[model samples]
Target: MAGVLTGVVGALLTLLLHGAQHVVFGAGGHSFAQEVRLASPPRRLIGMTVAGAVIGLGWWQLRVRMRVIRVRDALGDPPVRLPLRSTTLDAIAQIIAVGAGASLGREGAPRQVAAAVAEVLCARLGLDDRHRRLLLGAAAGAGLAAVYNAPVAGVLFAAEVVLGTLDYIAVCAAALMSCIAVVVAWPVVGRDAVYHLGAHATAPNVWVWVVLAGPVCTVAGIGFNRLMEAARRGGPSRAIHLLPLRITAAMAAVGLVAMTLPGVTGNGKSVLEALVGRGGLPAGVLFALLVAKPLLTAACLRGGLTGGLITPSMATGGALGALVALGLGHDQGGLSMVVCAMVGAAAMLATTQHAPIMAGAFMLEVSQAPPTLWLPVALSVAGAWATPRLATGLKQL
Candidate 1:
């Protein structure tokens, strides 16, 4: 029951996201980045500025009225009951912000909404705290599955990240919820992979390259995570009365940046797609994105924005991978740019999220990469996951 409701709400959230994008950026059938690229400079500037004003005022009002409990806090030991109304409103605001060119991921909104729905249902059913936690975690994962059509990744996310458990019962529940949500969402969201990759044979020596590159990607991922933490810490406080004006100015600055680099606007999906697609960006542009995307994303968070880091992290990783491929002379013919980017994405994602299996499954499910690439991806993810811990241990020693 929770799964079904979450799927429905998740699909509605997806529609709302698309509608917001269309309304904000005049995005007709194309991706958000493309629409931003196609828009006139004035339009880009005006659109983001207006969006920032509206979001700032709206969130200011909402935050002043009630304390918003994050999904993580709601899922704590006692399992606090989520306020459905506030959570739904928060989700809508997040969607609007992202649609209007915020450098944050849209996945967080659906997860929050789904968890709220599960909380409501648990109350009505009088479920125990344990059962409620399990259902809430599953629902959150199901929401991710619905949006991306990734059941396996959803299950892994629930078990590894949300619940922090690998118990057989929890895994089974997560799998069932994720599978149902994906099936339910197929009609509205489509069943195709979220990303399309061109046909490119894997380079024979890709494994060797991945083994060497994984640690580098992990270091980059660690840096990205620290930057985000710093941004969150330094962001404007809710007590500020001038939040709306401040946010508007910050978003305007983002618009100015987007005027030249439209790819930095959205959650970074289009950037990732471009990286893995045929005729990827030039080496210089890739390097620029590797530096700019994360910095811009961190800036948004510092400006009081709230959203997921998954896609942004993946995109940054893709840029790093592409750059590494170029540096290692694999871009010529040895390793395809597509494969290198995927390895980088997986490694970075694993490092940032601290979940190797989930990260690998997500990259594979979203890209529909062939099974032959699995071993190399696993090795890369393992290296990424282990490197930071080893470094920490060495420091302690």
Candidate 2:
């Protein structure tokens, strides 16, 4: 009962923080995207290069002079925490990256931010063992909810991925926090849904396509998961001696490539939006993007990457699936043919995250794409199955 109470409180906090983030992103996204577009290609490239350099330089100097633990490392040890300065800075930098087109998600920022804030509270409150971790989880959930404006999704993610289980107090606190965050963010972000889906086609449900899509998604999901692991940073676990140079160099490379395929850069929301509306891409262009996005993201985190895998991978998978469908020659997927490519994208994303509900919800929000997409559903399921198996096999190998 006590745990349940705390959980509810945590949930509310999660909701509140997530809501706050959504407002921030919504108010700023359009202008930010436009700014990127206005900048000369060279200028955009330079901006990316310079930002990466600064980030890298900071890393190096900080590590050499004092211990600098990124939020990613902070999370490695359970019951771990980071200073608010580091956490907030990461949130700001990452959002700027996404705002400026970094092909990553803004959602991760709140998680780190919330975690650090919760730790501060825990220390001041002198929370006990269970309470301390619970606070962290609740804070994370709150942050996610604030960004997504979906308390349930945040709750599930925190319980499933972060805390690894549900508890009474956590559920309560999270619920409360989620509510608070949303309430606070309402004015700034507005009550509009993230991605508006206009009108959806109910379904003459294509079983044949649905069945095939599942397997295809499975393959895609497995491929993506492997890519992430392969891209995992290679270096000492603790702070490296020369962190800045490494990150700056990686950023420079990513910037050069991103100029060619902006789709491959940033949190990928804009690209996905453009694709959904335009209903197709030059296969060659998309193919290049799919390859570049993952590889660049891989490079970005080589040793000290701080962000979430779910969003970037989802966008990349979608692009790959879309490209595949494009090759199949399906145009808008009109009433009959439907947009097979977009279907593939959504299905592939669903598979990789193993969060079909979240994937479905997110895609629905982001693309305003058709619903009751049976084929896409099947594919996402297939990908989820394959991703774990592949990961397991890779581990064995």
Best by TM-score: 1
Q: Candidate 2, overall lDDT?
A: 0.58
lDDT of 2 at 289: 70
| Regions of model 1 farther than 4 Å from truth | 77-79, 236-238, 330-335, 392-397
Per-residue CA lDDT of model 2 for 1-397, tens digit only, reads 2223223333443344333323323333343444445555676577666766665565555445544345445545655568777656656555554544455666777777677777777788887767777767766766666665556656656665567666877777766765566555455444555544322332334444444565666676677777776766463244576556666666667667756665665666545554554444666777787777777777766745456666677667656656655554454423323344445555666676666555555555434344455445545555555556777899999
What overall lDDT, based on C-alpha atoms, would model 1 receive against the true structure? Answer: 0.84
Per-residue lDDT tens digits of candidate 1, residues 1-397?
Answer: 7778778877887888888778767865567767777788888888899999999899888888877888899888564678999999989988888888888888899899989998989899998999889989998888888888999999999999999999998999999988888888777888887888875556666656689657887888889999999988866564457778867876787788888777788788888888776457778788778888898889888877788899999999988877777776665322377788888999999988889999999999998888877877888898987787888999999
Off by over 4 Å in 2: 1-34, 65-79, 166-169, 198-209, 235-241, 332-346, 365-379, 382-397
Best by lDDT: 1
